[model samples]
Target: MEKKIADALSEIDGAGRVTVVLTMKAGSRRMLAEETNNDDTSAVLVSRGSGYQETVTVQELSPQYQGALVVCEGAGDPAVKLKLVEAVSALTGLGSNKISICKGK
Candidate 1:
């Protein structure tokens, strides 16, 4: 996760050698949709090869983000800081208050 964010931030203009630390509020979760028939509801199943079956997945949810800290050479610049904040918010569903951008080597 840190590597992914670092790679993404490295693309920003003047954002050199980015490093990211992310804190999660919770782990990834998923919802399994149910199927209804004859007024009865039950778990949906997906058929597979060789008569195998598996539970049908309805939705996959990303982890809840607690906060993020971004370190980069350009973080001292207001523009770079703002961009990094916005990018981290979009990627991790974190608000600006939860994101900290700091200048680093």
Candidate 2:
């Protein structure tokens, strides 16, 4: 599952973007990644609230890759958070888990 998600994220083109919000027992965090097709490309992570109220925001979009968003809930765990990001990234192409975000370009 993790690999699937990573692959999806990695597959995004330079103009593509992906956003992910993770809800956890301890808190919530958000991550955003924009595909640059450059090895230096990176994603941004944001955090808000604590425990149930916690949330994460991520914005990854561009002309090439387009834009995508994903939301996940689970106990606070590093691995889980990573998985959520990967899952959301994979959704861009496979559309698995019915995860998608319909927002601006």
lDDT of 1: 0.91
Q: Alpha-carbon error at 50 in model 1, in Å?
A: 1.7
Error of 2 at 13 (Å): 29
RMSD of each: 3.0, 20.3
TM-score of each: 0.81, 0.22
Worst 10 residues of 1 by lDDT: 56-65
Point out where model 1 deviates above 4 Å: 33-44
Residue 48 C-alpha lDDT in model 2: 44
User: What range of 10 consecutive residues in model 2 has the weakest lDDT sum?
Assistant: 21-30
Q: Rate the local accuracy (lDDT) of all candidates.
A: 0.91, 0.40
| Clashes by residue pair, model 1 | none
